[model samples]
Target: MVIAVRTKNTQTVSDYNCNGRHVFTQTRELERPLVGSILQSMWGVSPTHLTWSALHNSTLVDYSWSVGQTPFGPFSEMSTLSFAQKDAARRNVLLTSLNYSISSAIDVLDSVAAHGGERKLLKHNQYVEFVQRWSLFKYKLDKAVSALSHFDFELALYYLRSLDHDLYGAHAIVYHASQELEASLACFKDPPFPWATVSVYAVCVVAFIYVYMKRDKLFRNKRKQF
Candidate 1:
């Protein structure tokens, strides 16, 4: 059971009422800086003050879940089991998503390497940066896995999300490099072999040789005529 309470001032609140459901209350002030700080601490990202307003707006919707009409057993035991099942489900989802992302990134890296023109396509500085970013991405993924193993889902999630920037930059670099390589290749043209010119030259040489070989007979006739 989840109960959300919104109050203007803590001291002036007279009624704390929820319809007989157990309350797991976490209180936070509606102040922007505090909310931003909390978000930064949790997600390792600094969000704008508008995040607080968005959060406030989201609280307007009441959401509930059914734990399958509580079995005829001890209430506490059933509640504990339900919580455990939910936690396991959450962990499974996280693991699946992390694995998918890792595999996709690996495929992208493989494609980049397989393009076979790293030296021609990417500058030395770009190659260095790509290597560094790839290493960092792997390191973060390792950390995320470690965190997951230790049941630190929040940390794992944060690590997983944080790699987006590096991954995107690497992707952009590869994409642009591939585009440049393709453009350069497209602009290149192999001049056709000059077969006709070579044939003409060969004919001229043969004619000159024949004339030379027949020169004695031609000169004898000319002398007779003289």
Candidate 2:
């Protein structure tokens, strides 16, 4: 359902074809990833997660990496830092690294929920946050995948980059989860409660109750409606 027709402007604008599928404008650097994203969708892999895995794993191998020519320039290369920047007002990154991070985190969210990972962080509200944000993320991801499938790279990139705010928020949740886990483990290893101090508190409570009852009765007998 994809078509490639020449327009008078020669700027290569993409839009819907006769069969209702998107058409490709130009074969930019995003073409391969777009096709790969479509294939990943068919194969039941998340496009965002796949992007994360590629970037994350690649970074472990090489700290410095860059993608091909973006709207910025052919010489300009996209990186995780560049993609995750908040000031990208014009043309956003080739791929949204933060968006991918959230997608990757959502995949493991079940594990975190099952093992009290989120609970340890005391971020029960994040469950709701994740659910709502993830729903939106999925919607955008679906649109991106669809756009990519029909070779609408610009729209696909737009949708992918649009998830930055939600993804950045997700990063905070993940950070808290890790911090909570560490704090709990560290604190749990401390010495047991001071039983001797607790016994002292118990005796004080018993003595206070005895004195109060005796004083109340003495006062009641003397103050009888006088």
| Clash numbers, per candidate | 0, 0
User: Best by lDDT, which number?
Assistant: 1
Give each model a TM-score: 0.46, 0.33
Which 10-residue span in candidate 1 carries the lowest summed lDDT? 70-79
Per-residue error (Å), model 1, residue 61? 38
**Cα-based lDDT for every prediction:** 0.61, 0.53
Q: At residue 38, give the lDDT of candidate 1.
A: 40
Model 1 per-residue lDDT tens digits across residues 86-202 = 455567767876987788788767877788755665789889888887888888889889999988888988888887667877888888777766434456689999999999999
* Residue pairs with backbone overlap in model 2: none
Worst 10 residues of 2 by lDDT: 71-80
Deviating ranges (above 4 Å) for candidate 2: 1-103, 106-122, 181-226
Strongest candidate by TM-score: 1
> Per the 3 Å backbone cut-off, how many clashing residue pairs does candidate 2 have?
0
